[model samples]
Target: MNSLSRMLEVLNLFKPEQPVIDIEVICSQLGYTSASAYRYVKELSNAGLLVRLPRGYALGPRIIELDRHMTQFDPLLAASRDIVGDLIAQTHLELLISELYDSTVINILQRSGADEQALNFGRGRPMDLFRSATAKVILAYLLPRQLKRLFDNAAPGDLERIGLTWKDFSKAMLRIRKDGYCISEGELDPGKSGIAAPIFDEKGRILGSITLAGNSERFNAFNREFLSTLMIDAARKITSRIAG
Candidate 1:
């Protein structure tokens, strides 16, 4: 990999569970020698992308600054904040505004209701493409070529767990497209169910998804048609607002 790509790989290692990593840990995890790990970490630290923590290394202040900038200027987030706020108020469910960037589904905006359980994801957190309702809606909208690439690169048996084969998975996606929404029950987080609908850009490209999440019991208590209609309407409104 190029130096830039290697640097990003290093940054990607710093996740929620392993937020602080030292040179030794990086070397072992990435199968790099001490020299290579130190070189990569040094370059990142020099660029202000990695900070030297007392224990190890953590994402530096630069990341936080960039996140702030993105949150302030992102068009979709700006357009949907108030609308999502309204959804949370109306349904009393946790609402997530997520987007498909390349093939990675990211939770970009979220609002939680008083009684709803908070999800593990947050702004910039990568949502599981195969698991979360928000991710599945976006996945269902991928171009054929994109879908093929994703399927080819995915870990084995992922398609099977979702449906059993490519044909089954395709049919499931078709159903989602026809209905304009998707619902998942305890698929990602146990006991948490979610309903999601896709948003499209002016060019009709899939932009992302808007999701309402709640405890499965609470979610089951609501009328399916009513909740799906509300989710679809919210997704459409966000799409239109951003497209405009």
Candidate 2:
């Protein structure tokens, strides 16, 4: 990797579980020489992206500042904020807005509801490409070449979760696109279900998805058809806001 790429890779090494990483671990994990690792650490620390800690290095205050800027200024988040709030108020279900970042899907915003079941997805967490309603909805709108690339790179069991073959997977995505929404049960989180619809940009290119999730039993008891319609309408409103 180039120097810039290697530096960014260092930041990606930090996670919720491994929040602090020492230079030794960075050197081992990234296959960098001790001197190179120290140089990278010094550069990152100077930029305020990493803070030295007794244990190691933790994400710095600049990350939080950047997050604040995104919350205030990201177009998708700004467009969906009020609409998502209204949907949560009306359906009393957990609402999530997820965005497609290259081949990965990540939840950008979420509002919890009455059901206390912990979700596997949250802000900044990656979603399963085949299992999540949020991810599936966005996948449905991906270009054919893009879809094929993901299909080719899919993990061993990933495609099997959705279909036995690529043709089957393509047909499944076609159905979701035709229907304008996707409903998934126990796919990401056991005992929870979600319905999602894709949001689009001014040119009608897919941007992301809005999902409403709740207990499986509650979803079964509720009017799924009506819920799907509501979700689609909300998605359209957000798309319009983006266009405007």
Candidate 3:
């Protein structure tokens, strides 16, 4: 990879859940020897994309700036807007399309197609995993260490209360990551339901997630199995279009 791409690649190693990584982990991603990984780490640190901790490198502020620039013109919005509009025309349910950001999702764009209250997450609304299907699905696929940090940060003692032990959470995340999708019921809001799946780029990195969501009654009126299938297919279609 070129310098810019390589820098971005290294930055990609830091997830919202796992913001810090050791030299070994970086080496594992690149399959490089310690020396090579160290060299790149040094270069990335010099460029301020990486902040070296004792055991791992945390993402620095530079990456946050880069992220702002990329999502300013989100492809998911540009490419999927019309398609999402058409889907809503047929389905009647609103769309809450979003891309995963650090431990959250910023709804870059959305389409409601319905004349009723238009539903679109604004440009900078910070959404969390607790109340968003897209956020949960993205969280399910996030790096384990990063997820742990989130869980710990959000609710330390509550994990056991919710039957969400670290081990159980890990197992669930593994399954979700394997399935590449999630169906959430009241995971975010009391009456809100959603189905979501990942969108990927050419290198198989998750670009973001797209979700189909509506009032519980409207969603319950439809065949969830079919809707889930459609959403998953749509995710693949979007990914393929971008990757192509």
TM match of model 3 to true structure: 0.62
Q: In model 2, which regions exceed 4 Å deviation? A: none
Cα-based lDDT for every prediction: 0.84, 0.88, 0.71
lDDT minimum window of 10 residues, candidate 2? 156-165
lDDT of 2: 0.88
How good is model 1 by TM-score? 0.87
Model 1: worst 10 consecutive residues (lDDT sum): 156-165
Clashing pairs in 1: none
In candidate 1, stretches whose alpha carbon ends up further than 4 angstroms from where it belongs are: 31-39, 122-124, 155-157
Candidate 1 vs candidate 3: which has greater lDDT? 1
Tens-place lDDT digits, model 2, residues 91-131: 78898998888778888998897788657787889866777
Q: Candidate 3, residues 1-244: lDDT per residue as tens digits?
A: 6756664676667666777888888778867678867888888888878887887888777878876776566566666766687678778777767777766787766666443644444444667764556776777766667877877776644354233677777776677677767776665555666778888777877678887776677777888778877888888888888887
Q: Given candidate 1, what's the lDDT at residue 17?
A: 87
